[model samples]
Target: MELENIRRRKQELLVEIQRLREELSEAMSEVEGLEANEGSKTLQRNRKMAMGRKKFNMDPKKGIQFLVENELLQNTPEEIARFLYKGEGLNKTAIGD
Candidate 1:
């Protein structure tokens, strides 16, 4: 009985480790995507700055629009916002406003 319990616990731990590895892989891929797009983002940001726009002053709505317009993100505004903000995305009224 003791050995069987240990084996079951070991199996559970292995499953958890596999899950963590998958999560880590996903995070790494996201980082790689961000790095790959960094150059374009920088150039666009610089252009906006040259036109007197402050870099960090963009609200969520405008930021979503800019990302879509610039083709920086292929997803819908809500999806992108949720991805970027981790589910703190704007409401429908907020987007309209």
Candidate 2:
């Protein structure tokens, strides 16, 4: 009786693990889809303007200091990221004004 119970529990754990693996596979595919679709027109324009460069060369600390001293930028990092990636208001709730 004890051996049968152990076998049953082991089978149950194997089934659960398989289900979790399938879920993880689906999630990874969704992430790949998002990455493939991330290149919008505005982003493509920005890439072209950079002349094949992958990343910016500016120092973030100095940039922040300049913005603060000149009062040129007012938004938070999250808000600025939304504007940059064009995902603004995507996750906003209806109750959020």
Candidate 3:
């Protein structure tokens, strides 16, 4: 009778262990999914640059001459912003504005 009880207890323990293992696997899967989602949600360099684009759009003028001269106007606002403080001849040396 005692041996039978021991066998039954052993069976119960195995079942409990298996259930715990399954729960752990599910938790690991959820962690992996969360990591994947976080990676996907990461912002691209272009998006970050776009956010910083507001500083470059200096003048209100829009034309071929403006584009050729400024060069920033040729691209999107983001691009213009990245190159805002960069490069030479951004400002004209004219005596008057």
Candidate 4:
């Protein structure tokens, strides 16, 4: 009786793992489909723009000092990100804004 119970529990665990794996597989497939359909060329352009944005040295310490001195730039990432997003069309949300 003990051996049978152990076997049954093992089988249940195997089934659970299989089901979870299938769910993950399906989710991945859906993501792939969405990625394929959602403006690939636009994405490529966005990637290039993002690469270029690295050159735009915001230099937090310097920027904050300048902002504090000039009273123009904001004090938070959210504010800075929104300004950049509107001005440059970059993704503020992706940067945790």
Root-mean-square deviation (CA) per prediction: 13.7, 15.8, 10.0, 13.1
Work out the TM-score per prediction: 0.44, 0.43, 0.49, 0.41
Off by over 4 Å in 1: 45-97
lDDT of 2: 0.52
Which candidate order results from sorting by TM-score in descending order?
A: 3, 1, 2, 4
lDDT of 4 by residue, 1-97 (tens): 9999999999999999999999999999999988887878677656654543433344434434454344454567796666466656333443342
Clashing pairs in 4: none
Where's the lowest-lDDT run of ten residues in candidate 2? 88-97
lDDT of each: 0.61, 0.52, 0.53, 0.61
Q: Model 3: per-residue lDDT, tens digit, 1-97?
A: 9999999999999999999999999999999999987776564433433333322234323322354354424566664444444533333322112
Q: Which residue pairs clash in candidate 3?
A: none
| Candidate 1 lDDT score at position 44 | 73
**Model 1: per-residue Cα lDDT over 1-97, one tens digit each:** 9999999999999999999999999999999999979978898776743332221134545655565565555557575655355423334434443
Of candidates 4 and 3, the better by lDDT: 4
| Candidate 1 overall lDDT versus native | 0.61
Candidate that scores best on TM-score: 3
